[model samples]
Target: MQSLSYVFPVLIMLAIGGYYVWMMQKRGQAIQNIGPAMHAFFARTGFRYDHMPPEPIEAHVHLAMQEANNWAPGNRETRYVRMYQGLPINHRQAYLYDDAGMSMSCNWSAPLPGPPRIPFHVADRSLASLGKAMREAFSNTTRCWSAKHPHAVQTGIPQIDGRFLVFGRDPNAVRWLFQQNPQLVGALLQCVEVDLWVDDRDAVFADPMQKNMNAAMGGMTGQMALGFDVAKRMELSIPVHDRMSDLLLMSVRAACQ
Candidate 1:
């Protein structure tokens, strides 16, 4: 009876441990199912799923996570990658990466002929999530640029809304761009956000301890080292893949011109 008591307790502990391991594996498998939905999204958008360029940004991000020891178990197993283009208009590169926690869509445009000498960023008024100070700085610094359209559309080609916040080292270039082509500004405003920086840095915040910051910084650094420009990063929440594609197409078209 005494031996049985010890044996029974050991068996119970073993059973509990086994159950915990099983639950973990099941959770991991559930994450694996996210890949198919991602695949379907690619098919719908006419992009080639899992057909990314060698050493793509997503891959680099994964490598960065590994280097920083920030990787979670099964994190690597859940990543999906795809390549796309703005067909019939722009041939520049575009791609998508969907991971366990975040999804990103990226597109590149041909370097503008004598592109504006300074970097600029524009964000939607409805979506500005930054602090009051940042908002005030952007407003004080960026003028309200307006433009008119030649087409007789239903809306009379609305003026560039006052909601956008544009910041750049060269306000004249931004003003000139808007003055020269209201249509271009209109196209850009349609995008969720735009970043036109000509530097090696990314939109990622500098704090290394923030969520995904290490991976973001390391990935951006790696891309710059590889001689590729990291132009913009638009973080997509749930079910934003289709919208991402449309906005990417519009932004690339407008910026390239």
Candidate 2:
């Protein structure tokens, strides 16, 4: 009976050890899935890979987790990377691709969507989402796209779209701002191609570094970096649509910084 009593404790210890091993391995795999997403996003934003901190910013990661359940992960058009790094010092900020082809500033947050006037709140979540996305996209710029009325459409012709609006750095600055954000240039023309490709795979984009790298390569590779390497010059313009193409480029410039 004494021997059996010792055996029972041994068995319990063995079970605990096995469970720990299994959990550790699973966590390792989860970390793997997020890597390519990071590489794609930040890489596209022109962040030097050398700048990759030992860990993600803690606050950014926390904010990301708060919105982790959000409907739209990040504007699909921006191909932004979402990461929360610890960096040893633990300064956290959500890393995202602004609609411009550049990195979102460290203090960036998706703004709250509310009408500029009282009693004129946004109704359709889709329009509100678009406005919040544009706020992220054009934070550093002078012009931004927002709904003019609760009845406006964000896409199509802004004027005819009633509630939809446009983003600008002022009349003279549009072209100059357009020159800054390259991803917006792609959003205007190539987003459909990207969307089609992303849809074909049904994979979620979680990393910015790898996304940029794959996109810079012509999107030949899967979101997870399966078995391909796209050429570095993957840029292509979408079909022109009533000057909408230029507007797309403008978004890229705004986001690119």
Candidate 3:
């Protein structure tokens, strides 16, 4: 009887775990169902998106560590796209919206060189306001900066104005990207933002949470979806994919001048 009791508990545990895994798989399918529409959306933007299932962590980590120079190697098995032929930076695992310029990919690997970092969602005034507060808090303790460029204000996209809040060990390279590529910056501002992982390296783990977080961030959008807070991960449609491609083309051409 005792052996049977033990066996029953084990069975229950297995059932529970299996059920949880099944639920998660269903949710993943629901998200991917929107892929065709997302592809079409990107197509309208004059960019090509090749949907690439997330690569193994070892591959991404090796790439990030060796060749990527400073880019974070994202999570394993988190589906994303490789975007190219249009963006200034050809990105792997870029979301459908605007190539790597504004993907909210959350497939980041931890144990990354420290000093927590939060990616600026869109470069605009609201984020700048947040940056000022952050700068005061960080106070030269780190190499982080909330970069605000006057050219952004001239863009006339109020949302794109002072949106410069960076938190990390060093954001100089990030700053350089913006300064050197004004059009890419413009495209980023127009795309939706997502939550970026910013926590102590030792605390993070490789697990389903990483994929879930990426999926959640991938599905969210809007100004409120700045990824600063968990509760703000709002459900949004991919309207910008259709709306911003032409504008980005025009802006990119103008900026080149």
Winner by TM-score = 1
Higher-lDDT candidate of 2 and 3? 3
Residues 155-180, model 2: lDDT tens digits: 33322223322332232333343344
In terms of TM-score, which candidate is stronger, 2 or 3? 3
Which residue pairs show collisions in model 3?
74-107, 75-107, 123-163, 124-162, 124-163, 125-162
Across residues 1-257, which tens digit of lDDT does each residue of candidate 3 receive? 88999999999999999999987675455344334434443343323322323554334334323322332454322232322234321222332333333223322222223332322222324333656578757863222223322122133333333453333223453344345556555555544441222233311111122233334356444333443321223122223222233333333332232
Model 2: CA > 4 A from native = 1-20, 28-45, 49-125, 129-186, 189-249, 252-257
Clashes of 3: 6
* C-alpha local distance difference test of each model: 0.39, 0.32, 0.36
> 76, model 3: CA deviation in Å?
6.1
My TM-score estimates for the predictions, one after another, are: 0.36, 0.24, 0.32
Candidate 1 Cα deviation (angstroms), residue 165? 2.7
Kindly list the per-residue Cα lDDT of model 1 for residues 153-195, writing each as its tens digit.
Answer: 1212245436554554455654544465565565555443443
- Which model is ahead, 1 or 3, in terms of lDDT? 1
Give the winner by lDDT: 1
